[model samples]
Target: MIKIEGFQTILYSLVDVIDSGIHIIDTKGRTIVYNKKMAEIEGMESDEVLGKKIHEIFKFKEETESTLIRALHSGKKTENSKQTYFNNLGQEITTINNTFPIMDQNQRIIGAIEVAKDITNLERLIKDNILNKGDTKYTFDSIIGTSENFLEVIEKSKRSTRTTSSILIVGETGTGKELFAQSIHNGSSRSTHPFISQNCAALPDSLIEGILFGTKKGAFTGSIERPGLFEQAQGGTILLDEINSLNPNLQAKLLRALQERTIRRVGDTKDKKIDVRVIATINEDPIDAIANDHLRKDLYYRLSVVSLFIPPLRERKEDIPLLAQSFIEKFNALFELNIEGISEDVYALFYDYDWPGNVRELEHIIEGAMNLLEPGDTKISPNHLPALFKKKAHLEEAPASKDEDHNKRETQESTLSLDDYIANTEKQYLEKVLKEHGMNISQAAKTLNISRQSLQYRLKKYQVK
Candidate 1:
């Protein structure tokens, strides 16, 4: 008995040196030994806890009892169990505890030793890991492009994410402005927070105001006192899409919100503090919008704290194959098809045609092609592409009516300058895609694989609207 007690004393002495708290309780819940760390954790001296009953030494709520004492009393062992307890000072601390029966030579339970490791830091780290998952899963990997221009825009956006300044994404429709916005949000420290988007053009003036500045219940018909995007996105980001579409009055209100870092509900008297990062997207030139009285110049200057221009798909043709492959893979999963790759001829056609609709268009085309593919087919041929793709005729039919027709064509084309000819060709292509997509700018932009803002800009530039 002397030797056994001595061994336990030495064992507890060693356990006291380690940071983890250790306690040994007999079958009746009487404390046999308590390490120095355990004494410190319970706000008692080692001598005070040496032989006290665990229930008496550590106070616990009656409803939620301690597991270690219960395990000792029940002769059951518990492993790697986590619990949060408040110390005498009411400071909450998290612990990972393991309690097991200490058996004698007869293999019968004698007492139980409880080992508890403070895991407050570990829990914090786990929370951080969960929050960071959003950042890693939706960053540049989601952007998907290999073109130099596209890569440069991504690089700049990545850099911009490190700062808290406002970012204005400028591009024609279907240029993936929101994707870039999301990438930036994911890359930033604010990744854990919400990323809210509001389309400025989609809502009417009254609704847009209520949507952005939320009204109190009974302030207006159907008002339920809901939080606005800014309020909902507190400590996160708010993406104002087609910011140029906001009327001058709303533009002023937005500027005030940006400047004050607070917003009052439409009918409320109190201004709520906000910590939202603003990222605005515009399809039109801000200078032109201001000149044409579409956007307020003051608001433009405030929103354009940091500006990034995404090149149109036509400008970055090198990325077409990469974007096409990404879209093909996405559609394959969505449609449950085995479409493996685009044919060499289809790629050649993709490169030759001016992608007036941009990246969005390419995605739709791939989805359409995937939908058209037969079961077990792994390749998408040019014939699988839409008829509009083949209408250009350079890849199919030879020039009809030989020399005389060629001469007449040359004479008609020569009437316009080289710049004008290119512009006309781009305009004609955009018109065709718009017509093909039933004048739905969003759908047309996606079918063209460009941003809606970029498509809208092209429509204006080509007078297609």
Candidate 2:
């Protein structure tokens, strides 16, 4: 056995790691154990109850249902009992308890242990309907932009909500494909049903197949009858994110499900009919995807009945201010801060930077800036923004004298061809910019004066970090 100073240390570690609140009492009804989770649920420290009685910690509503006092009296088990009480700070709390007598080897009652589960907020979750909780209800107005290009995509996505046919949304990561999908579902006839989503790139083929089509009992060891995501989304929508990530074999099965409107669970011969509308997304060019054998031509046609391509944020730079303002408003209400807006310098820096992660990255930057605001701060200034932003802006607008002095040393090189020299110079500049930015992708994109997509492509082309 491993040596330790005392067994109390081992017991303390085990109690703190548990999910539920655990409390144990001795035969004398004095508290011998109270864990950290119990403290959080009770809004009191463990020291408050370490050596106290049940009456000293909380006001019990029903002594029989709420306390170990009953177990101490009867020396019998109490299963699934519930209790309600007001904490020291007057916060209403609800919890269910499982209290039972702890007996020693002599079959004599020693103490009682109670496992408490805080169900205060869970009641609200049950009322809101957990099945529909994950589904977003974004409509056409949910997308914020007025540019003609953006408006066109919105109009197409809105039109897609009018039909039950398959849809294929193609865009770079974080281009709001899920937003578009949610809008379509909320506006469709299936609005009252459910909308579920899964990322194909996140799981392996064998597991993904079972999650998509479900499994029957005896299919494998520990397998039981369960409904897959498609079944759960009946009469609604199911988005297969990064559709190209699916293995070819699974792609064939998904195509069959679409064509026949039926799916067979793993190890089950019977086919179950489903009415889930499929919306698939891919970030790469469709033609390239086909050539690379990442997607089958037939499956592509099946899902592209109403294709919607979302343009990256770089293509719609005019919307940056609007998006930033919207994020500021969201955080202002969320954080209860008095921040009004961003400064002009911040706006200029935002325009100069290429958003590689699209709208999502912009939102995160605004959130981070808002979090740094002082209690009395009115608007977000350059100092409030992340350091990466300031560095990128400085590098992009650096003095031209630095480049001028370096160019003076070149003699119109004769050894290298003109195209080769230009290519080499471009490679060296990208590497230098990337090194200066030091993993700050947003800053690097801004410094290069190019879209995040182009920067990534150039980095790959030159084999640079």
Candidate 3:
């Protein structure tokens, strides 16, 4: 049996390792448990906060402003509440907190625990960078595709530049939806004005509300009179990437803003008129998103004044060689190498592979292969490919069987469709990497070269435990 002291030490260690800030206070509001993450978030030592009262360490203008205090008094949970206050160092800190009352069997509150996700840096970035002047890096010429379908899409987009109607660009991940949005922005009369781009998946609904719409001072603790992305992009363009990630309430607000051509800042009653062109992008089909309850039907009608669909890489295999050479030349110039181009065998393997990640995956593979070559290397051979592609190449290059009956038998036994095979392989690879990292989403995502939200989506789709 473990001693009480040893068990307490173990519990403290476990709490310290948690990703969010944890703070537990006694009934009288004396801090009893303050974890390592909390210390980092609040910029104070645990020693300083361990026995101190909440009011002594942090300043709240009113008792109601503190979520932990509210939970303690009301004996109810306060979830996903945003709090902005000054820390011990007098620096403003912002967090989304979930606070709960710890009650005994008798239904009497003993203490309160609060879990906080620090977003001070995110708030600062939104205020400083996102609200600043916006410029684009890619124009129409930067897009590299010559397929007839793609050219038609480009021509339509060019025509779209003549008007100020909102546009919706739909495509799979890495299919350059943003590239098209930027090209449209640069081609339009708004080209000389600011062009701001924001991903809807980047922040929680509560924080994102104040970010999209302007905020008024005295609205909440530490909130300043600041203009949001909409106001910042006035007279220019604003690209809301992955618009379906936004909740219904925000979507309604966005739709209203679009219809009225006016915005009311949070905590302010006056409606301000603005002239801003809205551009929204969805990774999947808008119809699918709408059917799945991810997007609002009304907002869809308002945002899709003009819709552009970008075809994925697999559908346009004719452009594979063109994109491959473009990336090869790009890397050659960037890396200062004299590699001529991809070998015929590599091209054959590329043609056989289903590019699930589309153009971005191709560029990443080419970049990886270029990193392996030296200045004297003549061309990118199959041997220079990444391990994943090398495996696929091996499977594609399986020697033709001389015995017809044996080949027919083998084919009959292995009859899984290409889609099924790729799906199974991807699921297995995701599971392997997740297990290696002990299911830490951020670490697993970093190792997979994808975003955390993307990893989470794959996990949910595959039902990976």
Whichever of 1 and 3 has more TM-score, that candidate is 3
lDDT of 2 at 117: 80
Candidate 1 weakest lDDT stretch, 10 residues: 127-136
Model 1 clash number: 25
Q: At residue 140, what lDDT does model 3 achieve?
A: 90
lDDT of each: 0.78, 0.81, 0.86
- Candidate 3 per-residue C-alpha lDDT over 338-454 given as tens digits, one digit per residue, 9 for 90 to 100: 778899988888888888889999999999999887657899987788888777556445575679769876786589788677878889999999899998999999998866755
How far residue 133's Cα lies from its native spot in candidate 1, in Å, is 17
Stretches > 4 Å off in candidate 3: 1-20, 24-31, 36-115, 127-132, 392-397, 400-465
Task: Give the best candidate by TM-score.
Answer: 3
Report the candidate with higher TM-score, 1 versus 2.
2
Reference-based lDDT, residue 397, model 1: 70
What lDDT score goes with residue 411 in model 3?
A: 86
In model 1, how large is the Cα lDDT of residue 292? 91
Relative to the unseen true structure, what is the C-alpha lDDT of residue 167 in candidate 3, on a scale of 0 to 100? 96
By summed lDDT, the worst window of 10 consecutive residues in model 2 runs over 124-133
